[model samples]
Target: MKNAISIAMMALFSLCCAAQNISVQSINYPTRYLRHSDSKGYLGEMLSDLDRQDASFKLVNAGIPDCPNCIRFESVNYPGQYLRHSNYLIWLSALSSDLDYKDASFRLVQGLAGTDRVQRTTHADVFR
Candidate 1:
């Protein structure tokens, strides 16, 4: 009975962790997914196994102090790197400063086109 209870608890914890892992896909181009290469973010097709890994990200709580409701996308492959917008362009970078935290933080809202999808809005209001 003890072993069975432990196994069930472990399985529940695994499911919760897995729920936070995701791949951002483009609505217009469903076959393309958001990926990072050369520290730049791009919507590209998953042509190889590495591409799939590059596209995967863990949805984590915002790194900023004030925004507990916001979220950040941490690259699964790169570990410490997160998706951040700079100069109107998105890039995968290692966050260090308050500015970096703000840049990386985003809110997930209902898609403008439809409710079936989600849209990411940046704290700077620069990217949608």
Candidate 2:
């Protein structure tokens, strides 16, 4: 019974990690957090902010079993949209069939020890 309960708890923890809210921070500018502009548009709208609410994003799985690390980020305040990089900038975009080109996929990685930085890498293998 104890082992079964432990397994269930572990599964729950994994599920939480699969759809966790994370803040993307700039490694270069440690004080800044990745953020989308107030305007709801694509391209040239990526920026950084010091506010946590503006920086928070829900990181969810892209549902590709082959690529376990492939994931998408959704805004906590906005629904039905995912984070994508356009023109080397970040923006929230609706779901698209062209997953390869939509640039909506990313991989979350831990930064150095004792730091609050999280790195997001797109499917193109570009870091943001």
TM-score of each: 0.78, 0.60
lDDT of each: 0.77, 0.57
Best of the candidates, lDDT: 1
Q: Give the range of the ten consecutive residues with the poorest summed lDDT in model 1.
A: 8-17
C-alpha lDDT of candidate 1 relative to the true structure: 0.77
Query: Over the stretch 62-108, how does candidate 2's per-residue lDDT look in tens digits?
Result: 76555566677677767667777777666676776675334787754
Superposed on all Cα atoms, the candidates' RMSDs to the truth, in angstroms, are 8.3, 7.9
Give the top-scoring candidate (TM-score): 1
Q: Give per-residue lDDT, candidate 1, residue 36.
A: 93
Residue-by-residue lDDT tens digits, candidate 1, 1-128:
44443453344334334755678889899999999999999999999999999999987776455544367888989999999999989999999997898899886655666645557788665332
- Off-target runs (Cα >4 Å) in candidate 1 are 1-20, 63-68, 125-128
